[model samples]
Target: MDADRVNTHTDARSETIRSATLELAQELGFAKLSIEAVAARAGVGKHTIYRRWPSKGALFLDAVLSSHETILEYPDTGDIVADLREQILAAVELLARPPLDGLFRSLLGEAQQDAAISAALNERFIAPQTQRTIDRLEKARDAGQLSPDLDLELAMSILSGPIYFQFLITAQPLTHDYIDRLLAALFAGLGPRP
Candidate 1:
């Protein structure tokens, strides 16, 4: 077979495996997912998954992060508050969905006990998303919507932490009113203290 054809075939297979991982993880939850199960679902050998990812956590991280990346567009509408509000609302809506909600709970529970899983979750999912948010904050800073000295990473945490807390810890409903209140509080504190 030609090299380009071979590459395309490989890419297709990788995507299939990732899709299978996402489905299995969503259905079975992260704690219950296994390489054998994923391999069976993907119609690939166990060795194939092992060759791509050394552990179940890594595979789950890849699948979940890739799925999230496809859906989460970086909102840059020039108005920083509107951009952040829209982005946070999208995240709340997405993460609060059925399978994803359970999947996140399972992954986070497992990650706490497994150092490798924790690292993979942070590196693959959390860090990338945070970095993207920071990039947006940087753009806002450049536009004079935010302070140039603002800690962009911390700002991301300030924006997302409450949502995660409500979802995972408080078990509170993330209603539109709650989102508005959250943003209001954040903007009150995070905006320039004139």
Candidate 2:
């Protein structure tokens, strides 16, 4: 009968509904996803969901993001070579994880047609991750580990592109050896011209 208890109950129910929506969104493509289905799955009324999220698009966007794992940390070990290698390995490892792979592909697929979703993904996810890597490379450049002219954005593509290429291209599953080769080849090109 109290406001605090009511708010707590409401918050818990909202989280349950949100998670159920994400599960459904992942299994059934976002376009086909419905709030009615989510409410049914969550054991909540349809009106409850509408109150929490105004539209299916908002629900799908929130679900996609909540289901995604946080980006891996970028570390500075003083040696740029070591740090870059670590970054490559971290990225490949993330792509290799199955749930992340599915969610990532789903997000990317959705972004192609939805400008709002695309902007959200870039801002909430990609841009911050890219900026962290870029900052690390800049530190390396300052320390004289890499060329002073290293283009951070291009440098990120250099690190990420091949892993995506393999993951998207080959039907083969990800493996450590495969990841090693991808990062090795990437560094071979990106490393200071020897």
Candidate 3:
């Protein structure tokens, strides 16, 4: 086969594998998901998946992250508060829903015991998302919306910490009102000093 056709074929197989991984994860939860099942679902050999991902955790991370790429992006709406609120709301909606919530919870639970999975989760998902939020916060700071000296990393943590707490710890409902109050307190603290 020609190079272009080969590349297309490879890409198609990768996408099929990712889709299969996600479907199986949603249906069986991450604990029960296995390479054999993914291979059967995708119609690809187990070796093919092994070649692409080092482990089931790596494969699951790729599948979930790729499927929800947009949720990780921070919007630039000029109004930093609005942008942050929009992105946070999107994430809350995702985590508060079925399939993904259970899938993600299972993945996180796995990560807690597996060093490689934990590192991959941080590197692939958490770090990138944190950087995106920091970048947006820096832009807002440059625009005078946030204090120039504000610690962008800390700000990013502040925004996400509570949401994760409620979603993953307290098991509280992630309501729009909750997000609004969170943003209100965040901006209230971040706003210009009197």
Candidate 4:
């Protein structure tokens, strides 16, 4: 086969493997997810998964991050409120979807006891989003939309904290209207004060 056809074939197979990993992880949780199970689910040989990812943790990280990227689109509209609203809405939607939601919940649950899993989850999934939020906040501050004294890292946490709290702790159903109202409240506090 030609190189283009070979590349396309590999890409399709990789996506299928990742999808199967998510499905299996959703049902089996991270600790119980095995290469053999994913291979069976994807209808591919176990060597395919092993060739792509050396270990279960690496495969799970790829699957979780791939699912996250497919679902969440962090906005960079230059207007902090618009960007934040977009980000929060995407996250809320992600939490409501059963497949992605189960993947994340499983990762978080396993991260508590497994250091490798915790590192992978934080590095691959959480840190990048937080970094993007920081970059956006810095731009807003530079544009004079935010106070220069603002701490971007803390600001990122503050911006994302409520949605996560509602999702994980309160178990509240996230609606568009709810996110709008929540953003209003958060922006009010983050806004310039006399």
lDDT of 1 at 103: 80
The worst-scoring run of ten residues by lDDT in candidate 4 lies at 1-10
Q: For candidate 3, which ten residues in a row score worst on lDDT?
A: 1-10
Error of 3 at 146 (Å): 1.3
lDDT of 3 by residue, 1-194 (tens): 12221121238899999999989988888889999999999998999888778789888877887777777587787998889889988886775677688888778888888887788777777887888988898888999998779887687679989998887799888888999998888777855779
Ranking by TM-score: 3, 1, 4, 2
lDDT of each model, Cα atoms only?
Answer: 0.76, 0.67, 0.81, 0.72
Q: Candidate 1, residues 72-148: lDDT per residue as tens digits?
A: 66777899888888887777767776768778777777788877777776665677788888898898899998867
Which of 2 and 4 is ahead in TM-score?
4
lDDT of 2 by residue, 1-194 (tens): 12221122236787798788877876775667888899999999999877655556656655655544354667777977667667666665654555446655666676777666566656655677788878888888888877677687797777766666666766466676776676566646745775
TM-score of each: 0.83, 0.69, 0.88, 0.76
Candidate 3, superposed: residue stretches over 4 Å from native: 1-10, 190-194
Q: What is the lDDT ranking, best to worst?
A: 3, 1, 4, 2
**Candidate 4 Cα misplacement greater than 4 A, ranges:** 1-13, 26-33, 45-58, 68-73, 190-194
In candidate 4, what are the lDDT values of residues 1-194, reduced to their tens digit? 12221121237898899888888887887768899999999999998777777567667777666656755555777788888788777776665556566566665666677676667656666787888778888888999988688877697678777777777778777788888888777766755777
lDDT of 2: 0.67
- The candidate with the higher lDDT, 1 or 2, is 1
